[model samples]
Target: MTAIAIDHDKPDLTGDTETQNDIFLQVFNSGDGALFDRLYRDDAISNFSGEPLTGEARRKFFVEFIGAKPVLEARVTHSYVAGDVALIGVDFSVKGTGPDGQPFTIEGKCTDVLRRVEDGRWLMAVDRPVAAGGLLPE
Candidate 1:
C-alpha cells in the first residue's frame, strides 16, 4: 500500500497513541471480523506468535481467535506519534473460556505501530506483544 504524506504542520491527534488505543478497543468490541479488513491494509503486517501476516491471512487470524474467546480487553499505558507512524504501548488482559470450556486469563504488554495509508486512513502496520507481570516469563 502507498504511504500517505502526512501534513506535519497539523498535529495528527487522530493517529496519536490514544487514538490507536481507541481503534484497538473499537475493533475488538465490535466483534465484527470485517472490522480488521477496514482497519488493516492488504499488505499490512503483524507479529502473531513471531510470525508475520499480511492480507486476508491477518484478518482470518483475528476472526478465528476472537470468535473463540468469550471476552477480550486492551488497555493503553503510553503512546506517541511521528509523522505517519503512531506508536502505542498498552497493557492488556483477556479473560475467557476457550471453545472447550477451559477458562484462561493472560496479561501482557503490547506495542502497536499504525501507519497512515495513501487514502488518509490509518491501519495497523505492526503489533508486538510481550508477556507482562504474571505467571508468564517475560
Candidate 2:
C-alpha cells in the first residue's frame, strides 16, 4: 500500500500555531508518516516517549507512530513566535489500536519548537510530549 505524501505547508498557516497544529491533526489522520518525515529536519529531535529521537531513530519512531493509524486532534493553547523560531503549547487527543490490537486513547499536552526555513516555512525542531505535569518520564 502506498502512503499519502502531505505537503509541508498543507494548511499554510501564517505563523499561527493553532492552525498549524490543526494541520498536524489532518496529516496524522491521513495515516501518512511521509508527512512527518518531511516536517522534521534531519537533526530534529523528539521526546515523545521519554527517550530522545533524532537522526534515523526519529524517523523510525514516527514510522511506527503513524503506522499505528491513530486518529488525533490538537488544539493549541499557547503560541509564541520571535524571529525565526516559535514555541507552541497544545492539548491533544489520540485514539488508536495498539500493537496487540487493543484500543487506546491518550489525551495529553505537548510542547513543540518550530523553526522557519529560509523560504519562510515552519518545521519542527524539537517536539516534547508533555504529560503528568512535565515531560514523559524516561
Candidate 3:
C-alpha cells in the first residue's frame, strides 16, 4: 500500500481496499473534476443518478454533479479483496442544494468494485448506490 498523497494534484490510489474509500472521499470533497476522473478507469461504470451510466453519459452526470458542489460523507462498511480485484460496501449521504435552489440530501449504501491496474494503482471499476429505505429529511 502506498502512502496517501498530500498534494491533490496527483493522488496516489495504491492503498488497501478500505483506504481507497478514504482517498475517494478526499478527492470527491475536493470538487476537482479532473482529479476525480483519475479515480476511475476509462471504462468505469457509475449509477450515481440511479441509472447505470458509462461513456459520455457518465461524464455528463459527473460534470454536473461536481459543478453542484455536493457534500459527500461515507463510511466503508465492508470490503473483500482477491488478487487484483476488490469489492467495497459503503454507507453514504450526499447533501447539497439542487438546481432549483432547494436543499436536498440523499442517503444510500454504495457497492463499489475496484481493480489494481498495471501501474499497481487501484481504480474504481464500478459504482452503484442502493437507495436507503427512507428518504432523507427535505
Candidate 4:
C-alpha cells in the first residue's frame, strides 16, 4: 500500500496515473466530455460496478456523466506496473448536482488500469470507480 498526498493548490500534470486522475477531475467539474478523447484509449472500458463498459455504450454514458458535472477528489493508494499494463487504486469523493439540481456526494475507492502505448504514452484501458473496495483483479 502506498500513500500519495496531492496538493490541491499545485497539481502537477506530468506523470502517468496522477495526470489522468487530475484530468478526470477537470473534465467532470467542467462538463467537458470532449477531453475524454485524450484521456482514454479508443477501446477503453469503464465500470462503476460489475462488467466494464465499452464502445458506443461508453460514449453515451460519458455524455450523461458530463451533463451532471460532478466535482471529484481522488487520492492514489497504490499502483503497480508490469510491462505495459499498470494497475492503480484510487480513493475518491464526489459532489455534484443531480437532474433535480440537488447537490449530492459520494465517497469510495476505484481501480484504474492503464497501458503504455507504442507512442510512449499512458492511456486508461479500464476504469472501475466507486466500488465497495479498492480491490485489484486477479
Candidate that would win on TM-score = 3
Instruction: Give the winner by TM-score: 2 or 3.
Output: 3
Tens digit per residue, CA lDDT, model 2, 1-138: 233344554423237776677667767777767666667766888886568888888777778888788988777889999998899999877788988989977778888898887667777889877665444773
TM-score of 4: 0.74
Error of 2 at 93 (Å): 1.6
lDDT of each candidate versus the true structure: 0.64, 0.74, 0.77, 0.67
On lDDT, the candidate that comes out on top is 3
Candidate 2 TM-score versus the reference: 0.83
Instruction: Name the runs in model 1 displaced over 4 angstroms.
Output: 1-13, 132-138
Q: Each candidate's TM vs. the true structure? A: 0.75, 0.83, 0.85, 0.74
9 Cα displacement, candidate 2 (Å): 10
**Per-prediction RMSD in angstroms?**
7.5, 4.4, 4.1, 6.8
lDDT per residue as tens, model 1, 8-73: 232222555655555556556556555544566667676643467777888787777665644557
- How do all the candidates rank in terms of TM-score, highest first? 3, 2, 1, 4
Better of 1 and 3 by TM-score: 3
